[model samples]
Target chain A: MSYNWNWDIFLSPTPSGESTYLGWLLDGLQWTLTLSLGAWIMALVLGIGLGVLRTVPNRLLAGSAAAYVEVFRNVPLLVQLFIWYFVLPELLPTTLGDALKQTDPLAQQFFAALLCLGCFTAARVCEQVRAGIASLPRGQRNAGLALGLTLPQTYRYVLLPMALRLILPPLTSEFLNVFKNSAVASTIGLIELSRQSQQLVDYTAQAYEAFIAVTVLYVLINVLVMFGMRLLERRTRVPGYIGSK
Target chain B: MEEFDWTSIPGALPILADGMLITLEITATAILIGILWGTVLALARLSGNRPLAWLAAAYVNLFRAVPLVMVILWFYLIVPTLLQRWFGVSQSSDIRMISALVAFALFESAYYAEIIRAGVQSVPKGQVDAAFALGMPYHLTMRLVVLPQAFRNMVPLLLTQAIILFQDTSLVYVIGLADFFGAAYKVGDRDGRLVELLLFAGAVYFILCFGASLLVWQLQKKYST
Candidate 1:
């Protein structure tokens, strides 16, 4: 039961000695970054569209958008990932399904993870965007109408810019959530950092060291993300308005 | 073409029901322990003692940064070895379950502490000052004045955290605990009813999560309004 507590095993040369563990970790970090960036872009685009739709003043469009947000937001990401990876291809047409199934499994899994993360995060983004839009003063829209600007123009030139500035902090947090949630992809065989750490632990029997490295890596990445967002926040701060505590 | 067998429901019902109980137990225990520990951590973080705050912060950061799957795996696979080596006691599956619960509770406490801290911070400074003016001791004032109001205001957020903890209980499956999802996978694997079994499991999850959402909605309406 007594482990020799070999810190040396973690520090030593890799078993194969051709590829270091740091190399594996860096590869995993690349996938993590790739997945998060892809997912964030999709989420932002779809979320903005859905957010605008939710407030379109048309009941059906608004209600449908609301439903989308509710369903995706309420479900757990892990379950959604499972359904996306395992069931969606089977439900497709034969030719397309076969093509999807025959595609590189790793790529397919990564894409599925991206899709699920994007869709799931989109729900939250929709809510944030809606709140941002709603928090706008009523007079802005009225002034836009008074100036003979169209509704879309009001949203584009006036409302969205100001609203986005107001909601930047929350949006940043949502982005962070998206990044963290990418770890869930590791469950489905994606070679992300968490999974890579697990593999290293399995091989080296150095769970403590492996996890410590993983934790430090995560904290570092998250801190860097937060710092960058803080700079963005300051850059976008409204001139006259003092930020509330 | 194999006809979709809808008739598995009657037989699967009892088995799935058992799994539901296990799921509920895990979720309930996690929430209970998580809330208790989380509250303590929150208080510690908010305490004036610098070292205690730092220690609490470190604990929170460590757990929150690591994925829950890793935490559960550590508890199930490594903790047993560590326990035997350190204490000379053999560990059982039951003990493993307890370890999982402890690990999850500790992890979740970090999040809950943040939530609770936010709730506490939202309270007006004048209220605490007013309590102090009345000559109430710090601990008594916190217990009687601050926490009750903070907790009351935090009902919606607390429910949200509970829902998350409930969902995360699925991570126990990595350690071979036969919770709802694990049961469904087992049933599917046994009969090659993968799609059907998963759909059934998804329905159960949706129901539980949706129910939690409805409860939260009601609570928000009742408490906030």
Candidate 2:
């Protein structure tokens, strides 16, 4: 049994002649990084808010935060992407829906995918944040309160700074996961790395080479992030903290 | 801008329910196979054999580092050919489900291996020493003393991972198998009621996963003692 192998197809220009196949993939890589980093910013902000709310004394706020985490975390990312892409625009008022529809298609897909991934990863990050806060000594909160700090100020000056540092290791994993999870955006036509590979396979019929290239890129991203986080962890480690080692 | 129609759901439920079964079947089979495979990997990593430990670690690391969707796509493209050459199973028969099952199980085993390894390590070393002191053999000590405690400690984690696996089962749609998510997408596209059908699908997924997570929380509480 024999099969044709073409390692050089990526260098060949596409039928459109605008760019080579490798250019399309690099463009896809650019989008993947952009989307992942974009969504990660959203996840960190929303997750921190929700996580703080979960630890607050107000039952209503905490309950709502918990509910948000439960709903978002339970649904699959692909399903959520579909909802954001196809269903959400229609669900809005006609003026809003029409405005969204009138926007460029790629922009719409990018926004929908970005929001979907942001919200989805936010749920996971919320849990990590909650766990980090909860693992702190109860007296830490009390000390801040006793020191005349308001609740918000306490979280800002006392609880959160320590908690964030404590959770860096888990946060690193979550960051890596966001990059990996960005692949689901391709289902919504976002043209990220996985979709680019699929398109490469379709145009070139080089399934092995396409997928292997995508896999290597993914690994490279993950490894780079892992080492970066390890260095950050080492530099920022608190003496006698949980992950100081 | 169309009127939000709820009636399309009932018409779509039966087909979607069939797809849900396929999703559930794939998830269950994968969880079982993954746990079995993960247990072996966990033991091999702990077995003090350098090559075996390296092999298990490499497998876990490679699978963990890559996205599950890519793994599914790879298996879809490659597994059938390997299956045919090795087992003489013709490619004509429906192999999508089998390929999905194999991919999910293998991909998930990496995660499960880490969880089980942690669980095994959580068991006190003294217990193994005590078992050996009782003249129990290595396999017997592991089977009778270590594994039971380790599994008990890890039940909640295992269940949580299973729920994650259930959600990920939707990725099988890439291979064009009509799992729950695929069925919804197809029915939505066919009838132009994508909004209603997909909303319904998301709700179903939410309920199942939320319910399972609640069960996992309860298990954690129960086992915390």
Best by TM-score: 2
> Candidate 1: TM-score?
0.93
Worst 10 residues of 2 chain A by lDDT: A236-245
Interface RMSD of each candidate, angstroms, one decimal: 2.3, 1.0
- Model 2: pairs clashing at backbone N, Cα or C within 3 Å: none
- Summarize candidate 2's per-residue lDDT along A33-119 as a digit string, tens digits: 999999999999999999999999999999999999999989998899899999999989999899989999989989998999899
Judge candidate 2 at residue A22 and give its lDDT. Answer: 95
- Chain A TM-score values for every predicted structure, listed in order: 0.94, 0.97
Determine which window of 10 residues in candidate 2 chain B has minimal summed lDDT. Answer: B89-98
Best by DockQ: 2
Model 2 DockQ (Cα-based): 0.79
